[model samples]
Target: MVNHALQVSAALADMQIFALEGSRPFGEAVVRHLGLALSAHEERGFEDGEHKARPLTGVRGRDVFVIHSLYGDATHSGNDKLCRLLFFIGALKDAAAGRVTAVVPYLAYARKDRKTQPRDPVTTRYVAALFEAVGSDAVVTMDVHNLAAFQNAFRCPTENLEANKLFVAHFAPALQKEDVVVVSPDAGGIKRAESFRQRLSHAIGKPVGAAFAEKHRSLGVVSGEMLVGEVDGRIALIIDDLISSGGTIARTARACRQRGAKKVIAAATHGLFMADAETVLADAALDGIVVVDTVPPFRLHAGPLKDKLIVLDSTALFAEAMRRMHEGGSVTDLLAGR
Candidate 1:
């Protein structure tokens, strides 16, 4: 880890770093970490369900970064989120903010990066177009559901930050060759598992085998999984993008255990525990669960999985990005995670 807190100060006296967000805690963290001032606002909702906003400071010609995450529920409408985002970003744009850069950590509709089914909409590109329509000059997001979605959506430059890099380094030392088996929880994550395997193999200086478990996500039908690689008495690291209801994760652990795996640990970017997820995950898994602090903060709540949960901070990551952009440096270098 770097010793200093990376700073992003405006080069020109007129230029400023403005961050707006849905969650006050995440937004406030970005503001404090970057050493920027906040505009006073009473952002609340009316009884009639109308959102009300009052900006206390003028933001004419300042570069604003709207830091909002939309990755929990499949109802991730980036275009819709952008629609609401415009109410905020547009105000700044009209206020003469020099430019608006979207600092969305969890991208919505990222899964629909391509048209796998007939007549299916490619929402990722649509979300990109929405940002452009709402006057976004650039965007910085973490762990996009689909990598190419960023490039396809924006005319301006976009950076796809990885939470995986954080995990690979953080967890590599504790993993033994026989103790760790890189397992993708579903078929959709084969590419991610391959990348993880490569990282682990290079780190350990040995071949790290890969395994993918299949699960059919329908009603009342359990997934009959077939492990493609060996994991007998080995630690299973099951990695995925997000966990909503905990069905896939709980079942993944169960399936891995049935295959004679010694232990199973789950990791993901977004942890949106909607239902009785804590009880499900806590009772099912053999080891722990690691999640990134991207969406709503997880510490504010309590659950059965609290003892087993590890929440990683991403504030420094975004704050560093602010410094890099301000310094006229390469954002790609941060994404490559070298």
Candidate 2:
């Protein structure tokens, strides 16, 4: 282990890590876990609303990683952040950086991977193309909406970090003596819920029940009433890739309570609380909510719902992945909890 640590340290000699404006806090946490400091960078704003960002120090022939989470906030839109990241990457490549990897914790437009409507825009693919065009060598993100679609969209190497292990670690001890059931908010997320269920079961050394609620969306309205499997007297754990608008989570929590679930906890990777999500998710049916610090809970305010919200740290996971990639180690092994 000492030798391996030394080798990894050596590998990082030529590495450069930069955090964009929006993700400074998250990037600092990642660097803290890696026992390093963030590299210097500069960002300038123009009177015409244009912006520029570039590394302050040299990055020539270095393995550069730019940490930016593409989620909109009150200050800057998602498009603004994306454009800044792309431009910074282009500047790095233009300055002769050996490799540039985009470390996006919460990738925007990932939900639009497929075209559900006629003449719909495939924004996910377009975003992938923009990254490639900027000369990005690889991209890393956590728990994308569709793993297959995300992988296929990018010709460059892409890493999708699963948050199941993190959730399992968080829920195992408390649930060991309780009757637990993992639930998917909609039929489409059955696979994701099953994966979490399997991991949680193994962690607690018991069988975990599985269920899914029926969800149908037309235009912008969501209407569904059907729910499968039994949740009576059991703790219903609802899982999804993200929570946007909080409609699905609120609906699922209500159904779980209606079916006699003792407690309903919603766990998702990204917390993109858009629109009136704060009000919608504050339902009494939901006992608790869990999410990672991918997209910060900027929209949530002090309230009962804020009291129940739990945000877990994902820096260690990303830090380890970066270390493994730099040291030519196995990211697959890391994910397998080895």
Candidate 3:
């Protein structure tokens, strides 16, 4: 067992965590909020695009958490990124370092949870196994697609965090007193939207119901279809887990307007600007957009439409989570976004 460095108190002090970067500072913000010493990193890249990573600080017996956001091309090529991550993890394990936690703000292969399409691999599960094998004592992530993916892959503990608290805080205020309605962009997202609905309803103290839009493989949602619930003339807030292509948001926002929705807003936990997502969202008729900075919100290439996009910090939230975990307290307190 590693010598844990957190100060022992009635409540645990989250400390000694370090943040590394791969063109994003999501982890940097997270560790900074904890007031922990950032781990010293010495990383360089080869002309051929290979990379090397080393920690200059001694971690011999100290609990160490490594934060990285691993996703797709906007993130990196699938296996290439994983290999890079594993290399770093292996380096730590080889050093006889203390327990290592892999903190992924956005788990990459979550959406492909099941082998819905033919000959598809359960990549998320495999990746989880890779983490355990590479010396991860625990795994922390947010809003993964295959919820069961955690259980299947790791021999160690796995925790998934939700962004409901953050969303309700910002979005409820944005749509205040406007007779707002919470909406899910698809049937699959009804659960996420419903969770948001319950929280918003409790906070605003009114009848906040939920609606959903649907599409069958098209980029945009099916047009001219009445929403699953009454959306006519009500301001709509679309809550999604993540935005990769921005198609669903644009489609749902457009459909809401068609159904007499006075205004539309989009919010998500992760802002994954894949392909022309920034462009698509900018052209959509959304009044404003908000996203948690779990996956770094700085890269949105929305031109003038960037002004409409709002980025909120999730670093503080993650930092608190690390604090609670280190203290051996109930992570459940904030699990459902209380």
Candidate 4:
């Protein structure tokens, strides 16, 4: 057995961890990694589609962390999961939890951070307001689409965990050789790709190259088929924040292949795989796809492309973050690469 004393201390002895129905597996993994058990919670769904989640154990004057990834699955839509998490946080506050942290691994609606057209919702800010209204002292999530927007959206303390170290470690062996180029699916993600490239290069002890595709999306239509930077005869590693509908990654992969890229490997922080994504991602030019397990692979399992899918666990990363937060330690090391 692992040493619980080293993982937990008197400073966090009054802390309790809970997980909603949709995030049980992820929460369990985190708890197991931390050498702890999940606190008791009860969730009930009403016939009219209403839901309620309540902590079975006492939380009064105790620090509480709730794990719920706001990603949609076959049973629950993203909005459904978000609403449930919000309500549960509110309930915890009402029950007098000392400090409440919502550990949302895959935060949904993060892409709607900005206003592009008239009367745009700016849903990210609105979601932040919802969390604030529910009395969340802090919000923790991994790889938010817009880091600036995510921070500005929330009034409460927010921690945006980076997956750079995790990705770098996972891809180090394959990227040790030279002639590898990290490509961002679009211009908007050029910085993200560059950061990944820099760390990957450092890991492999070589100077990796960077490239980006020009993509414009308006009203469900995507255009701009331009590839910048050299990709010919090089292994292209496409990096993005997440995948939804799989259009951008597919388009970028095809663009790279057309430019004579030897191989295309795609990596994203979250893999939503929505609406025929499996078919779209099964492109001949793509060699493999890597994603962190912030959200479980509901769509990719038992599919034809399953063989090419690689999932990296985020449990250890999250557990370390939680431990630090509970013990009043700095999280700067976690955000080093990005």
Candidate 5:
């Protein structure tokens, strides 16, 4: 494996990187790839359930990156994490830091980017405003629910990293000889699946088929039965940005199996695994599931789904992006495999 830290220059010598209490492990993984140590930060809890976090070391006139994955879990709600992150960024700016960038692996409220119903709240835009209010210069995240909404919502510079290369690197060799079809769990994700399919086809030196399952989500209930494109006797690979409750992917897997798909696998960037994911994802039709280690599988237990789950490391990808951003290199070139 390549040591990503060796690729860094003195340009990052003065950079300040911090991982909050909930995100220390992932932050450590990112800094490990960059061959740097985590900067000191202090978090204190007050009476009546309030908390505060601030940099222990000086950050004056230094480029700072805060690693925080704002995903709700048993320990903390998404709201709590978001509040803390914003407060920390505000503190950094108040300390006269030159720039503060939020490196959020699993951005929360991204799915609520738009309104399907009347008078719906655009939480994604509100979240963007929070970051901007705290003097955030930029935001970096991976595989958000809607790329367009994510970019347009943030006034600050935003980098949306794709896990395509990583997934391709993992799946290509294994499926190189098999007849494969990439299926989007929903119509909205057709573009994402197709983008992944093209790269995967190139990686395996073969053409891959495309498909999408009809899905309509209403008030947390998923309903749809239409399956488009052919999957008969071909390895079916379902692609999506996330697996919340596992309903969409599980339903799509069943649809693929009903249409005579030889094998059904699902690859999503963030595995939120909310609600009854452990039960839903345990479906026999889903042969395997692949997800990056952006959000830990805290909601999952050791069982059938756990046995089929594979977590890919995303630190190297984030590390490279951070390095490039700090050095003013082209992140687009990196994603394009240039």
Candidate 6:
């Protein structure tokens, strides 16, 4: 028989939470929701653009969870943040942590799950390899670009949390009496839009409609002005995994309005808002945008788009996931809000 006493001891062992520099605020929110204190760590950058991070406290035999969103900011690129997170995970493993789970709220390079062009790099697989190389026992992220590709790329245990329920809950009241249609900005996000529509429909006890905009990209240019499905005189909720430059969402919103959509709103799990994203999304067709707090919307908050932005707190969701993972409890209930 398995050693019951050993299992109990392991279960009772205190878990430590560490947040990397770029994700400190977000991690702090999650820690607060979990009633835990943030662990101390030291990070220093050399004059040569080299940096290092080390946990101040001993992590030997402890269950360690590192919170870091591998998204770029003013000072660091996405690659830089990824490297720092990877190195920190490796460091914790070297320190003999019994287990290390990487909690990446916004997993960068996730969109590059596959190659569309010849000789294109499969960055998602490569990132998964890097995580495995650092000895991560499990990788946890939210609303990845491609679920199948993400699961297939990682050899270790991977958990992808969904934001569908959260979004549905947020929009339930507003859409309860209105005719709402969930729309995918592009054909590739049809699955995501469908999930959102299903959950929202169930929550509001009404049959939510679905629609999609066809988009084609060539050499960084986007085309395809056609929209599929019924959206005329209905509130359109354009859904996607993330919003970077805001071009796709804007294009879809415009198309929806042109198709007689009464109102156009965009909802995404991550709001990257990169490079004049505010300017791009300021079009009159887009009424507002809702996004989860996976990535801090510093730029958007400081700009004119603040009035049109709705940010939902994801700390509770992440806290619950971490609790279940640490206690060896089933997370199925948390997946699609079962």
Task: Give the worst 10-residue stretch by lDDT in candidate 2.
Answer: 1-10
Instruction: Give the Cα lDDT of each candidate.
Output: 0.71, 0.93, 0.75, 0.90, 0.94, 0.91
Q: For every model in order, what is the number of clashing pairs? A: 7, 0, 1, 0, 0, 0
Query: Per-residue lDDT for 123-169 in model 4, tens only?
Result: 99999999999999999999999999999999999998888888899
Q: What would the per-residue lDDT of candidate 3 be over residues 144-175, giving only the tens digit for each residue?
A: 76566566766889888888888888766655
Please provide, for model 1 over 1-338, each residue's C-alpha lDDT reduced to its tens digit, 9 standing for 90 to 100.
Answer: 74343423434334355444454567678667666655565556569856644345666766566666754334424444555565676666767777777778877777778776579798878877777776778888887776766677678788877787777876788875556788988787889878877887777777776788887654445575666778778888888888777877888887789888898888888887767676688765558888888875342257568778888888778877865775667767875663
Per-residue alpha-carbon lDDT of model 5 for 205-296, expressed as tens digits?
99999999999988878899999999999999999999988999999999999999999999999998988899999999999999999899
lDDT of 1 at 217: 51
TM-score of each: 0.83, 0.97, 0.88, 0.96, 0.97, 0.94
Worst ten-residue run, lDDT, model 3? Answer: 6-15
Cα deviation of 45 in candidate 1 (Å)?
3.8
Error of 1 at 182 (Å): 1.0
RMSD of each: 4.2, 1.4, 4.1, 2.0, 2.2, 3.8
Q: At residue 333, give the lDDT of candidate 2.
A: 91
What ranking emerges by TM-score with the best candidate at the front? Answer: 2, 5, 4, 6, 3, 1
Off by over 4 Å in 1: 1-15, 18-21, 39-47, 52-55, 71-82, 114-118, 176-178, 204-206, 217-224, 297-303
Candidate 5, superposed: residue stretches over 4 Å from native: 1-9
| Model 5 lowest lDDT segment of ten | 2-11
Clashes of 4: 0
Clashing pairs in 3: 233-260
In model 1, the Cα lDDT at residue 225 comes to 62
